[model samples]
Target: MQNFFPAQYSTLSAAALKDYLIKVYQLDPSTTCRLLIRNVSDTYILENQTQKYIFKIYRDAHRKCDEIEAELELLNILKAEGNSVSYPITDVAGKQIQQFNAIEGIRNGVLFSFAEGKVILDLDSAHLTQLGRDIAKLHQTTSSLKLNNPRPVFSFETTLFEPLKDLKPHFSEMIEEYEYLSNIADKVVKKFEEFDTSKFNYGYCHYDFFPKNFHFDEAGKITFFDFDFAGQGYLINDLMSFLNHYFFHQLNNLISREQAEKDFNTFINAYQQVRPLTDDELKAIPYLGITFHIFFLKFFYDNYDDWSNAFLTPRYTKHRVTLIKKWEEMYCNF
Candidate 1:
């Protein structure tokens, strides 16, 4: 891994930044700027002079600059169709991604048109239903574009299993739980693979559609950001990520089986109303949803070694156990 550039401090001086803006984006020097949140790769959010352009600086150069550029291009395509996506701003010559030299290493950056809405986590049933509709619209829009980007798969294999492979020895203490989830992940892949996924006509999708990455305005309209994980996949896989978070993870209590079924069906039905699901997709839902729950539970649980700095609570762990048992009883006929 390359050394991380310090994102906490702005490497560009105020004067230097102003000059760069003029060269890259043709902006004024007296722009007011404020810091937003920092991401894993140390991307910094710098509001340009007009308050319209938000620059995303990738502190790490080797981590697929081309992929990020492609993601921005996809967003631009979706936004042009009036799909409510965050669009990237271009250089002075109107290029989306700008390659620059930095001390930590060679890195890339891109500017985006600031999205207007706020990140909404707390929502009522109506709002949840709206989210379903918006996501369906997003998937539909991407499908129409037919843009293909061959990125890494975001299933249990890539996101969870691969990252945790080295930590398997550390998982010996929790061998029972680890092995159980490992087997479950394998079963899910096998079951889903049993059918021809291509038969369902895989399309481009925002693979990670969690609430934090979404925005909703005062008028009940929703928009999305963070297309970093956007790629080709079965549409239901995206649905599973959203439903798993809502039904199992987000709620405060052990979600009652009845409520779980209700919430799941509500979301699925609302989505299908806008963009219908195929028969194979409907059959795969129960397993895929449960698999998502288990995958994230173990994924979070396996990160306990870093728990010292982590704010993860005991309640979170208990909820995973609860979810696992409930999924087993509901799906496996326990």
Candidate 2:
């Protein structure tokens, strides 16, 4: 007998997953399972004649067991509060997480109720308003509670400082870009010191609220998914991420800056109708936006081995830094 060779990452077979799920979750035997996406994690779509489901297998490097449990707990809470989120589904054993030992190591998977809609990129006024209200309603639950399982926390330390330190090795070749990030991060910290953060609303933010993470049915109902980046931070972090959609839209000339502002205002107004935001919190969004960019830059660097090596080249790194500079010029006062 020969020994099996070790692997860093392995793709699980869809046919095998279909069989396992059918047996464990009591899914229809006729259901088909196909890989939907293979990124930081692997997403599979399983469906039969009557129902559809999403099974996500998380990379241990990206998300560990505790973090996955926390995410499931958050989704469970959101679903119970009547939020339109794709939530975890339990198997016949009443377990939401399924364990598998693959060639690499142990991988955790979860079956989620399929969100019934498609993504709407060019959102109209009605879509914007509904999205705002739904997000506010979701925040109502996320802001109030704490999870027993641990998840990442977004803060000056985690998002700004730690990322900068961890990314130094990756940025060794691009000293100017690294300096720009460090200087801007310092400015962001100084700017935050100026604000009376005691009034800032704190909670678990969706952290990645771009239009692509959500879907809208023909009836215009919005369902948000992909909580992979959800964490404790300023609740306004969610709002800032939504604003990023408009920022990119204006940059790419998809929408005029005037209209982007008007559209964002519509979303803000609807959000305020449901939940009140302080003036200081609104003022801090752009600065928080800086941290968002730097955090993700480090993320790309850290996950380059598992993700794309060619995607995070010196040119890409410089481009990201340039975008951060442009963001500062457009929005920041300091």
Candidate 3:
């Protein structure tokens, strides 16, 4: 047999995955599997007559085995606590993660119970309130426990300073934009110093709470998924991410500033009904929001080659910086 050429990234065949999953998971022979997304990780949808599941294959560069274990551990805890989260499924051999030897190297894959329902972009008052309560309940668990394996930590060093350093080269042509990010990062750090962060609720945050990561069932129950960015951080990071939903809505003219504030406050009030948040913590959200944008900007730059080659251009970088400026202007006082 001819030696296979070395590869950086390889797309696993859906047919091969379907057959393997059927045997490992002991699924019905008639079960079908199809690729759902091919981003930083590849997502496959597997379905039989009565059941459906999401099988995700992780890229070694994006998520190491230990990090993947941590994510699965987090999900298992969430599921056990009765939180509505899509969780990993164990195979007949009691293995939650399957090892695949692809052209590049050994890749890890997991089967997740499919989150039932659809994304509701135009969330109503009840939807927002339920979402808030459920998220706070989830925090009740995530905030209290520690996982055996390690995941990312969203600190000023990781989210702000390190990203700035890593992104310096990408912004070589956009020195002004780079300076803006650096200055704002400094401001954010100083702003945090003004607050009594001792009272901030510390825990693992979803980090990407945009509506798309969650689904609303026919009865309005919400199930959150996509824990790829879940990490150790202030619990408020989840609230900040959900707030970004309204930020973009107002930015796109889908909703007025007045309505956006009203809607987000609905969520905040509901969250507080479940778990209390200090005024200082609420005040610090905008600054943390600044870090959120900068962190993702660096993510795009770093993963561009593997994730979004077409989307990460100089123009996109400048546009992202412009959006960050707008976010600061809209929310931050300093």
TM-scores, all candidates, are 0.75, 0.98, 0.98
Q: Which stretches of candidate 1 lie over 4 Å from their true place?
A: 1-19, 46-50, 59-62, 144-149, 155-173, 193-198, 248-251, 254-264, 289-334
Name the weakest run of 10 consecutive residues (lDDT summed) in model 1.
Answer: 303-312
Residue-level lDDT of model 3, residues 159-260, one tens digit each, is 999999999988888999999999999999999999999999998999999999999999999999999999999999999999999999998899989888
Alpha-carbon error at 27 in model 3, in Å? 0.5
Angstrom error of the Cα, residue 32, model 1: value is: 2.5
lDDT of 2 by residue, 1-334 (tens): 7777988888999999999999999998999999999888999999999999999999999999999999999999999999999999999999999999999899999999998899988988999999999999999999899999988899999999999999998888889888989999999999999889999888899999999899999999988999999999999999999989988988898999889989999999999999999889889998899999988988888788877558689899888888898889888999
Clashing residue pairs in candidate 3 (N, C-alpha, C atoms within 3 angstroms):
none
Residue 74 shift from truth in candidate 3, angstroms:
0.6
Q: Give the TM-score of candidate 3.
A: 0.98
lDDT of 3 at 325: 97
After TM-score superposition, the amount by which residue 48's alpha carbon in candidate 1 deviates from its true location, in angstroms, is 7.5
